[model samples]
Target: MPAICKLARQRLHWLGLSVCLLTLAPEAAHSQDMREVRRTVRYLTSRHLHGRGYTHHGDQRAAAFLARQFKSLGLVPFKSAAAYTQPFPLTVNTFPGRLAVTVDGHKLQPGQDFILAPESAGGRFTASVVYFDSLALGQEGARQQFLAQPLQAVALVLTQPDYQRIQAQPLLAQKLGEARALVILVPGKLTASLAPRQVAQPKLLVAAPAWPHAARQITLVLDACLQENYRTQNVLGYIPGTARLDSLLVVTAHYDHLGELGRHHFFPGANDNASGTSMLLQLARHLSQPSHRLRYTVVFIGFSGEEAGLLGSRYFTAHPLFPLDKVRFLLNLDLVGTGDTGATVVNGTLHPKEYQLLQQLNTGPASVGPLSARGRAANSDHFPFSEAGVPAFFLYTRGGIAAYHDVDDRAETLPLTRYNELFQLLSQFLTHLAH
Candidate 1:
């Protein structure tokens, strides 16, 4: 019995060695491509790509580059019979030109001093300002007074508490949607998001009062475009399996982010998604190699319109090119630039066995720290797959610079703390999962 056990251990070790041998070139080539990752991130986040948004052909440029990479890696078409990219249409409100904001006759900075709301309807506005305590938004009398005056330009000076109160007032939202050129004075840095839908008015979020609230008028010299059916694409390619070719393992990452703030400053989404997309490409290159082919088919996807919502992933699931039931598992990667404290897995709790298996496989590779399991979040491209009942996990690195959806998330700053270890862990996990 002792001899048999030793023999078993010997065989398992040899098997592992064989697998590593087959994967050596692909794995090392991928690790060497961290330089490539940096290059790709820089290109995607560069000024010319315009933050990879729907405007200025930035998103399309990124799609073209990724498609070229896919072709170069010899990744075959999957789900699509015609091409590597799956085209889709979506509408987004974009501030493409003349984004100027003036308060009380003083022209303030565009990105530094204020942000135009995503739902804003574009056009120039010159109106006498009516200052209201954001606190008043909690009171019906105060809200009604502002809402009742249709032609009046309103400004709400918000403290954190005031902002909270205003959020509770549903009627205020209804009124604001109908109001034109509303000014909101917010404390701290200006953040932006893609509008879920367009509205009849534009809201300007300005930095809170600098020297008491004496501004009596507001002016916006803006040129915002509401792009309807803006054509964008999701890039996809696959490597067939030697055995279970029909069964699939999907790897995905969203390549979209908040594009440019006018023509001057682009939001470089390096950590937001460029990191993840670069990793996806690395994985693609590794799997595309014939020597490293798996027993189950693997698909690589670079999703667009993720910032607008999980539109691409949702569309893919709704109209999948392959059978959803044939899917063995789906792994969604995002914000993978840092892993000082290891990584977090969304939906890890929901699928304990697979999660446990991953952790088990992660035991030897101490470089990535430890894996953290988290509750499901709809904040990424994985949400749509989770909704469709496809077994999925969204993985993201947890530590390092806290650059999220902002301009600071540049390619030059990413440390890639444990990217190699993360890659190794996934490689091991997928091997075990496929087995």
Candidate 2:
């Protein structure tokens, strides 16, 4: 099957969570600089960055990298805007030091036999094991009873099906966390994530086959901490418009991704927002040119803590450098690595004028492939601005690879399919904005 067709089918199957691992056809290439996009993705996904998560100050490294990119591109901070970065603080749970788990005499491996819970409170817990059967979990009355009861002993173990059911209700953690420890039997693989909040009890996962059926107890040691005021920043740069000084256009992409799973494993996030950030940098490079400059000032932002929440953009819109009313329009990009089928626009219906303009430019023989419109969503950095009454749209490329929030979303595997075309389409639309 053709690569585009396969990606489209897979994308339809995955419902907006996918990536592009196929090769970019040379004949499809355009003048837009994909070399820089490739280079940026490669460096960001490199091991030293540790998936750009909070685990190792990789997020700070990512912020610094964006600042450097902005400085290199000759874009300057708007008058009221602070230097380059607007730093903020957050509290999060992290497992950077020691992580270990064992049931009886058998050792459990991270992301293999067992995994530590992201929200797990850091501690060492050992006690006699208690089991919760699938029948108990499947029964509504028993499940409610389990949630209400005070768990005693070292750890509580559950079958794979029970574990999945429990995971569906995040608030269930409050109950589970009251236990000394919680254990789940995973069937095959485990992909860990950064937990937004904390649970009082430590949690461990065990592989189904490695589960100690006869074991009386379990032991888990995790050097995790709920670090408060963890500092991070957003990187911003702008090109003063040649025409209207008061009016402006803002373009943005979140640069944060799921950080280190442990010491050895990290999610690369090549297609998540790194691909979108690469697009932002390329736009900065292009729009900075005097010949390509716009009628309204163009602000480019590389947002942080987007994976944690829309923290950076929310901060900026709340404490905007310039007046919020001055922003003529905002376009936020999340995943732009592949456009095998086309691109989808969030807020297309809410902001019909801009959406119509986009449709106009996205057609013709040299079109930017198919364009799909979606209703309002708080799905990306655009939401905060939209809620603040600023017209904003988040655009993400559709169809490609299926890797997301995992180690598989690598730079080498991304195709950059239809990237040049989308770049052209956006530039054309920007040129006609408010004209």
Candidate 3:
């Protein structure tokens, strides 16, 4: 077995044993205290949250719920803002109209069989089909050769593992224009459950058609367009500092996830994000108390449009309430609910001092290790801040549960056994940073 997977499995076994012992022990009070984190995780990862994406009311509702929590925790706005919402604009494509696709005299049902590209220009075209295998590889030349043929027709592309490379190549679209060929993607056996009736934007590897003659009598009809004028907001809350207020410590987590595909499957995103957001809220509750004064102001940010590509954090850095230079450190929490064994801290190697401090705080007999550490990598909300020359770290737990980025990442399955320890470690780290 691979080393990482082996380590993960071993850790999982340890965590399972720990949970069993905790349940059997007479320390019900400790278990009950930990239930708060579990309950919050479940609530946020519930079906009602709709994956916390922009397509549904999930993002807005989550923002409101978080703002309420911030208010209850006594976190006031940093400046003149009335509330905790840091509104921003995001351009997104939405399917508000109709989509149609027809192949070889048969009309294909939307969402049931095929979906059009979001940027596709709606049109009806009768032409032959041309097959190009692996258009991103030597297929580019092969595609040119096919187009050079006397016949104009629909083009069938058999994409390989280089899906992103194919998508990036402008030659595909340019070839379609030159050959006047309609594009038909022959995706493998369409599983009813996984297939969308009408995909907002279809990007998938397709199998090559059986016969070359099958291309001669191809006809396709597609109706699709891009919507450009949509916007989303990120929620922000802060507790002002007392001494040396000019410096800042920011806590961030993305609250967005993949929205509902149709009606049935919602990527609950419990651990993908909602878990981290819950931790942020809990930490805000603890630190926002009047007694917890610090040298640097603490800003808690709940970013949106993260699944869409780190939009919220990018926007915040671009138009920061406090000068970006004044920001001393950003600690981004993500995927912390299921870390019964331990958690991994990204960018830990980049900031050895902070990493050592975290390890020291979590070094008790019952606590989980600092886990693995890696140098700076632009993977999450911490990316933008780090790019802007701010010291930042992305912290997440490792092992315990395997659920991630799927519907199974539900709140009910999260074992938040180490939450109190994690929180304590964070509190200590913040104190150390403050000094």
* Weakest lDDT window of 10 consecutive positions for candidate 1: 11-20
| Candidate 2 similarity to native, TM-score | 0.82
Give the poorly placed runs of model 1, Cα more than 4 Å off: 1-31, 79-81, 138-164, 174-179, 209-213, 364-366
lDDT of each: 0.77, 0.76, 0.64
* Residue lDDT tens for model 3, 1-435: 267446534543543444344335423365554655565566566656666765556677677767766765667775744488877766544333334444556554443344333333444556555555564345657667744654343444433333344556675544444444334454443211111123322332223342233434545444433334335678887787888788889999888776553344456777778888877876776566556667778888999877667888998888887788988788998887767668888888988888887787777665665477888877789999999988898988887777665546677777665777777788778867877
| Residue 10 displacement (Å), model 2 | 39
Top candidate by TM-score: 1
Local accuracy of candidate 1 as per-residue lDDT tens digits, 1-435: 467446534543543343344355544554445656676677677776788888888898788777777776778986463579888888888877777777777888766677777877676867776555553465667766767766534543335445456567777656555545666667766677887566677767776754135777777777778889998889998888879999999999998888877767778888888888888877776776777788999988899999998888988888788888888999999999998888999999999999999887787645478888987889898899888888999999988997776667888898888887887788777767777
Candidate order by decreasing TM-score: 1, 2, 3
**Which lDDT tens digits does candidate 2 get at residues 202-298?**
8765667878677887777777777677888888888988979789899999998877656776778999878998888777776776677888998
Clashes of 2: 3
Q: What is the TM-score of each predicted model, taking all chains together?
A: 0.86, 0.82, 0.71
RMSD of each: 10.6, 8.9, 10.1
For candidate 2, the lDDT comes to 0.76
- Indicate whether candidate 1 or candidate 2 has the larger lDDT: 1
